[model samples]
Target: MASFPTETHRFQSFDGVELAWTEMGPGNEGARPVVLIHGYFSTAEVNWIKYGHAAKLATKGLRVIMPDLRGHGQSAKPHDPASYPRDVLMQDGLALIAHLGLADYDLGGYSLGARTIVRMLANGAAPRRVVLAGMGLDGLTHTQGRGRYFHRVLTNLGSFERGTPEWLTEAFLKTTKGDPEALLRILDTFVDTPRDAIAAIAQPTLVVSGVEDFDNGQAHEVADLIPNGTYREIPGNHMSAVTRPELGDAIADFLAA
Candidate 1:
């Protein structure tokens, strides 16, 4: 029945951009923490906290470090497209780990956050474990259609009629209070870890997907990329699955293993 209080902190990223982090769990100095990266247009609150992901991890005596990726939450939202360098999100996570002086940890993310984790591994990170949710093998290549859809929504925000995909997505983005222009740039600069690189990450991994969400391609294929990886399916689609206790539980169980 124990619960940890939320503590927020800001650390300067390598690029000098200050990013925000929400830390939870007993602040045990020796505990190897878990870093939860959120999807695009998502904050620490949405992707981790509100959905009870952090809480579940906290109850297991695991520290949860949830950072609001720059341009998404309370982090700096530079409106200029050119300001977001390629691999900036991955850089933020790596910078945070270094700033905390963590020698070992588990890392995971959903959607865009998962893609960043892949890049982190491709860049030589060797986390104790990784949870890749709402992403698939197709993540290793261009998500052109996905990017184009978000682009169209951002550029033609008001043009879509109610109940349409663009309209609904715009509404969701507004709910997160993310800057459309900043998010557009995020999409602009997003890229995948090369196929060869993804296949080479040998760390233990869990690839979780919703029963109805296969938009990113084959989940099994993504799992196959990791020599020690496995895949699991939960109840909902990309967005709805975030709130399911199953999602959090699955991640917790994997990291604990």
Candidate 2:
């Protein structure tokens, strides 16, 4: 059974790319809203709804909005690398929030999604409260495994040796049904969002990570970077953390507080 009964839609990105999104729970007036961004190669259904996070929030009377970033899932998969300008990926997210007319709301995302949220903060989009999950300070400094290895995987494809990070990344991307060519170019444009700028984010923030997850380096340190950030540890690692109930529970409790 699906975690949340979602109403999905397709919208134009800031660059006119057709993007996809899904909504669960109430309208703006019915309850508070949260915009959740999914990680690279992941759709809204995989990241939020599949793991019960969105449904849990919806049950708490909060509206959850999940968008599949461009070049992933149902969104446009333009194979051209130039289609993704360095400054526009995060803008796609901000554009969605503005389209929804959400002046006051919470926001969150996981992995690449979290990185995008940090860039959004750096770009001056302030939500009432924010959640940065499965991401760390190292990630915002530059694109590490996300760009280099994912790019390698695409370039080599089946040539990658089994058990390597590139191999694993290719498998994961394939599992998620990601667009290979679009992702290859996404590597060219993945934002190395500035760390000093991220520190300027003053909104109350929650940085959640699995105890074993360090894909972007130290989780606690990333939380410390924000003036008002708090770190919460859940069980599991990067790939498995989102599937755990504790992750959703922690998020629900923190947002409610």
Candidate 3:
């Protein structure tokens, strides 16, 4: 089973929100740290540990850190939309790096976490390398964001009506604690990016997506947005992409490279 070097610590953001984290691997590794950011609505322990991937990376001699984003895991949940703004999340992450005294590191995130990493790069945080999985270029589409998207996802409160596709319910159930209304508002507020903003990212990015994933296309789109980047596809959809070992191997290999 995959596992990570485990030690828990806390850091306070600029606004006094206490952020919780699990640091993995040997802190003595000469290489830069590898920070793992979990998807929105998911906590680091549930997403990384449950899959056994954390241990795999730890054994590879990479320093790893997984933080519970505000409102998820052990982190404080402000429940205020302003507190979770895209820019604010990026700033909090930078604060975490500074707190650890890491001058540079490899960055990795899944789904919402991945999206946040992208925004962080655009905002000028320089991680030596980046791994963006489960998010792609197509960004969220109106078709997916309307009707079922809003009801089934944004406002979905646990469990997918049984007998309905298990995947549908599971994904929705995973994201329930996140304020749907707040999410929608943020989406509306940050909808468009200036063409210049898209061109701002210069990081060497590894764009990863599952061949059967909903955001595969978007993952490609996100890659195109970066000046120096590459894309690779693995088997499975969003959830399976994270749980499967092959995916972790691919990520570990890419970051090590």
Q: Pick the candidate with the highest TM-score.
A: 1
lDDT tens digits by residue: candidate 2, 11-111: 78777888888989855576899899988778888899887889888878888989888888778889876688885678898899888888989989999
TM-score of 3: 0.82
Lowest summed-lDDT stretch of 10 residues in model 3?
139-148
Off by over 4 Å in 3: 1-4, 29-31, 140-160, 163-167, 170-196
Instruction: Select the stronger candidate by lDDT from 2 and 3.
Output: 2
Residue 54 lDDT in model 3? Answer: 71
Model 1: per-residue Cα lDDT over 107-147, one tens digit each:
88998889888888877777888999999777657667578
- Candidate scoring better on TM-score of 1 and 2: 1
TM-score of 2: 0.94
Cα lDDT of candidate 1 equals: 0.85
Give the alpha carbon lDDT tens digit for every residue of 7-67 in model 3: 8899899778899999878667584588888975577887676676676677777877899
Candidate 2 vs candidate 3: the TM-score winner is 2
Clashes of each: 0, 0, 13
Off by over 4 Å in 1: none
User: Model 2: clashing residue pairs?
Assistant: none
